[model samples]
Target: MKFQAEACTTSVGGPRWERRLAIERRRAENHARRGRRTFRLSRIFSLKTAVKLFLKLSRLQARGEANARRPIIRRVSFSFPNLPTSFDGFRILHLSDFHFDGEAARAVMIRDMLRGVESDLCVLTGDYLADYFDPLGRVYCNLATVLSGVRAQYGTVGILGNNDHSEFVQRFSDLGVRMLVNDGFELGIKGESIWIAGVDDPNTFECEDVAGAMRGASSGAFKLLLAHSPEVAREAVEADVHLYVCGHTHGGQMCVPVLGPLFLNASCPRRFGSGAWRYKTMQGYTTTGLGTSAIPARFNCPPEAAIIELRRAR
Candidate 1:
């Protein structure tokens, strides 16, 4: 029931050489994806364009755009019977889906929003770049500026999302955030520890390996899984994951009031699409994320950064 530091291997995940291969592999995949009829059709008949036009006509574009910029803090607490006593009240600052463009507004807003916040650990689920083809220089710099304001005792760990390229692993790692692409490790506090397993983008890239990420995690131990999208919820549950954290749906980025999100884009159930939900004995939370995609606006669902506190249930 104890996690050994040495049990975690540095060999797995995206190594330097693996990253190079991933770049080539992903390039090929992107090329193929672009040639698909669905992809071609979507481009020809753009939903993003239609949505933008509708917003502009209704005069809600400004409001939606403002909503996208105005992110809020979400706090939620969970109690676990098997959680280590020393780790009680452990706070995890979860930020996801930056979708950072050339604009500095979102980054500055995030920095200002997290001024006095503190946490034991920080986790980032991906989609860092605003567009798949956008250069990384601006995105990386803006992300660094935002991270500079964060105050996490144990530092940050992140995984890639559908929009991110393979090179982001090394680039972000250089920024001090441990990149966990199809890899995992143990985090300890006061002699007690837990396993954190992370996978690559399962939605677009389809390269996620949950089993590989959970390689060293022992059965019945406290296991936390990080994924770009919640599509892997079933696999996580089967792998005995305790908590699954993700952000891809964006809480239906643009909702229709009472109907909720128009599209989840993830394969998981609607119940697990946003906020917190339970499956069997496992608990999970899907963040609304920090930025908008497609249309770059939010309707009822505003952007968010989460403060998740873990308490020991006695």
Candidate 2:
């Protein structure tokens, strides 16, 4: 009787142990499947993200190339009733946002476009290099070559942009581009002087000092301010700047046909993103600029070099 009971217990225990093993094995297999599924989902997500980013970048590049190929010149006329008679009919070639980078071909294209363009003075509002943060030596050389074609009687005067660095101020100066960092330059025509006061980039570096730049400006002198961003136009108005030139906003870089600038990337009104406007008594002009920013391409809004003809209003 004892042997039979022992045999029965062994049989029952053996089946129970096998059943437990089977249950655990199924759970392990299920866990493995879940882990594999999770990994695949994660990989797919990462791949999708990378592809999206690449596609967006490519699109911008395409747009940039297209804009570069078809360079446009905007001939604009501004009548300043208060403008000095000496500066009347004074034509300024306003070129801004020359974030020069990429292939040498781009520089060649710029040279071809500016072949016959003429101006009494050339004013580069800022952003000579496309990305100062990149390996900069090449960018510097590119700038010199690209701007070589730009000609003016009084030469080129520049102000720093948000993307610019402290070192570039001197570098640009060396290239015959007078970079004014909260400084002033006096232009004398037949003993009459016109003050060109420039402030550093007002947005990115926040180094602009309107009062400091205008320190030596004579009372009631023809004072013109060169600013990087039009965001500071209001401040210039308060400071009694007669004319303010800027170019940080790429005229909404990529604009929608009917809706206009989709992203102005500026604090001022969308209208100020490009073209001429007035802030109180101050006349302000913002350039669509010559090159793209953030990305290398543009859409709808083509790259342009602005020719501003200053006329004394009747």
Candidate 2 lDDT score at position 287: 88
User: lDDT tens string, model 1, 137-205?
Assistant: 898888888888888888888888988877777677777777787788888778888898899888877
Summarize candidate 2's per-residue lDDT along 1-314 as a digit string, tens digits.
01121221111113323443454466558767774235566655664346446647666556555765576889998887767788888888888887776557777777778878888888888887776445467656777776778767777777778666556766666677777777786777666677888787777656577877787888888788999889887778778898899998888776668988756667888878888888788888898888876555566888888999888899
Q: List the residue pairs that clash in candidate 2.
A: 64-297, 99-129, 99-130, 100-130
Which candidate wins on TM-score?
1
Query: Which ten-residue region of model 1 has the weakest summed lDDT?
Result: 1-10
Number of the top-ranking candidate, with lDDT as the measure: 1
| Model 2 misplaced regions, further than 4 Å | 1-64
- Any residue pairs clashing in model 1, and if so which? none
Model 1 backbone overlap count: 0
